[model samples]
Target: RVFDVLVEGQLAIPALDLALEAGTYTAVSRQYTVKVSDGQLNVRFATRQGATLVNGVRVSERPDKALP
Candidate 1:
């Protein structure tokens, strides 16, 4: 939260709600879009960043193998 207020909050982005969460991250500089497919079975994040994390742990710089 502090990072968004102090650092991210200062960003000149519009309609951007920066939040720390999980999943495949790909917003380079917090710019991207999200899409839901597979009948809520999968989520697609189309962003500029390529960092993906799970359980708050960075698993890879891009989308990792889906865990079953």
Candidate 2:
């Protein structure tokens, strides 16, 4: 089973080095919003269930991949 945790209102993903024990793989989509104001930046992630508000971090000016 996939476990999702929210820290300080932000969703935190487990480190990639961890191995999954057993479960059928499923596709999941995550959406994020980045906002900037007064030189301060904020990010939020949204999923089908609900939304998570992130703080103290900003999206990179140049994303390695662009979204359509």
Candidate 3:
């Protein structure tokens, strides 16, 4: 699950800490890679699934602010 993401001018997240704790493995960190490409920016998403919270705090909102 993506807890948070931030991009600038439609950039990419070079490095992010990700983990999988399913049947795939008890736990694994930084074993995945994320890629960002153009022509498909500002993709719209629905909130019909309601809100996703982490540690009792909301964090499902997609990033919209530009990074320097």
Which candidate ranks first by TM-score, i.e. highest? 2
Residue pairs whose backbone atoms clash in candidate 1: 26-49, 27-49, 28-48, 28-49
Writing each residue's lDDT as its tens digit, candidate 2 over 1-68 gives 23344443555553211124422343333445433334654333334333432223434553644444
Candidate 2 has a TM-score of 0.21
Q: Global lDDT for candidate 3?
A: 0.32
TM-score of each: 0.18, 0.21, 0.17
Once model 1 is optimally superposed onto the true structure by TM-score, how far is the C-alpha of residue 18 displaced, in angstroms? 5.2
**Global lDDT of model 1:** 0.30
Judged by lDDT relative to the true structure, which candidate is superior, 1 or 3?
3
Ranking by TM-score: 2, 1, 3
Candidate 2 lDDT for residue 42: 35
Per residue, candidate 3 scores C-alpha lDDT tens digits across 11-56 of: 2432223433343224432222223455333422222233422332
Model 1 lDDT per residue over 1-68, tens place? 11211122233333223443422344424332223233332222323343422233222322653432
RMSD after Cα superposition, model 2: 10.2
Model 3 RMSD vs true structure = 11.1
Residue 33, candidate 2: how far off, in angstroms? 22
Clashing pairs in 2: none
Model 2 has an lDDT value of 0.39
Model 3 stretches with alpha carbons more than 4 Å out: 1-31, 39-50, 55-68
lDDT score of residue 45 within candidate 2? 38
